[model samples]
Target: MNLLHIDSSILGDHSVSRKVSAAAVVAIVAANPGVKVTYRDLDAAPAPHQSGALLAARLLDPGARSADQARDITEADAVLDEFLAADIVVIGAPMYNFGIPSTLKSWIDHLAIAGKTFSYSEAGVQGLAGGKRLILASSRGGFYGADSPMAAVQHQESYLRDFFRFIGIPDVEVVSAEGVNYGPDHKQKALDGAVAEAANLGRALQAA
Candidate 1:
């Protein structure tokens, strides 16, 4: 199976989400030998934020596109194609100010193309890209569980989950390492729990 692994954290080596995501990838690869793994680090190479110019470039003939427009549109198409080709996708999403990184959001905008990923009519919206597994390696400095008093202010995981669902991936799995900034003990405990869950998820993928 093809696996697409993405990391959006700008924290580099100190990123908790990156660590958790790497562990998940390692576990998945160990369980399923010969799985083709493709990786993208959004922080290292980010997609340009969506803009009117981007739309214009898409509308223009390929031969007429300027160098920069060609480059941007090409990357956008490549991102969408990668998601379509992947059987399983794992993405690292660290909460920043209660939301996701702008780079990650930019990547997602590429995948949410009408007709390519979804369709809507009088019958309502229908997702075209179905049957792919999505795993989110999430991290946050604060507690925002469903029962937490701060849940209402949380938009990271919830936004991602809803967005994926809108694109036709109905089952979104998450392995979260939260409260990392609380203290050393909280961070270690959260990492341990998330790693264990990631391993279990990897094993399940092997069975599938």
Candidate 2:
């Protein structure tokens, strides 16, 4: 199986999302034999945001593209291709300002290509990318669950879940560590819950 592991935490070793995601990956690897994993750290190598000039470059012939455009397009295509090739995708998405990291959003921009991931038809929009499992390792500073007071302000997990659904991936498994910034006790509690969830997810996947 091909696994694509993506991390977007800027906090590195101090990142709760990173630790949870790493645990998920390790657990999955242990459960599944011969799984080839491709890892990408978005904080270290950020995805390029889409722009007008970049959009125009796609219309031009390969030979007509300038050096910069060629490089940009190549990088974007690589990101898209990686998403397409993965059987399982593990994402480390940390909440930032009530949403996801900009770097992770930038990476997703490439995957939402018209003909590649989704398309419009007479019947409406149709998603081309499907039959892949998505695991989200989410870290939040505060509680944003349905029972929480701040639930209405949450856009991080909801946004990601909807975005993946748009690409025909409706079944997204989320292992989240919330209230990480609340206190040391809360952080440890949340982290343990998320890690245990990750392990359970791995065992479930292995059984499947």
Candidate 3:
């Protein structure tokens, strides 16, 4: 199986989402022996944010693109191709100000291509990228679940879930550590719980 693991946290070693995502990948590898995993750290190498020049480059003929535009287009295509080739995708997404990191959003912009990941049809919209599993390791500074007081403002996971669904991936699983910035004790407990959840999911995948 081909697995694509993407980590978007800027915190590097101090990132709980990274720890959870890595643990999940290990579990997947353990369960499916010899599974090929490709890892990308968005913080280390981030995709270019969409811009007018990038958009123009995409719409223009390849031969007409400027050197920089050509390079940007090529990079975007590579990101899309990598995502399309993956059977399983694991994402480490940390909440930033009640939303996902900009780097992660930039990565998504590269993948959500027309007539590639999705297409318009007589039936409305059709998603081309289906039959794949997506696992998200999310870290948040505050509680944002349905029961939380800030639930209404929780765009991190909710936005991700909707984005995936729009692209034809409806069955996304999230292992999250919330309230991490509440206190040192809360942070430790949240991390511990999220790590355990990731490990358990990995074991279950292996058993399956």
TM-score of each: 0.97, 0.96, 0.94
Which is the winner by TM-score between candidate 2 and candidate 3?
Answer: 2
Question: Candidate 3 lDDT, tens digit per residue, 1-208?
Answer: 7899999999999999999999898888988997889898999999888888788778898888889898888888889989999988999999998899999999999888889999998999888889888999999998899998899999999999999998999989999999899999999999999988987887676422
Candidate 1 lDDT over 1-208, as tens digits, reads 9999999999999998898888888988999998999999999999867999999888999999999999999898899999999999999999999999999999999999999999998999999989998999999999999999999989999999999999899899999998999999999999889988987887788735
Judged by TM-score, which candidate is best? 1
lDDT of each: 0.92, 0.92, 0.90
| Per-residue lDDT value at 123 in model 1 | 94
- Regions of model 2 farther than 4 Å from truth: none
Question: All predictions: root-mean-square deviation over Cα?
Answer: 1.1, 1.3, 1.6
- In candidate 3, the residue pairs with backbone N, CA or C atoms under 3 Å apart (3 or more residues apart, or in different chains) clash, namely 31-206
Write down the TM-score for model 1.
0.97
Please give the RMSD of candidate 2 to the true structure. Answer: 1.3
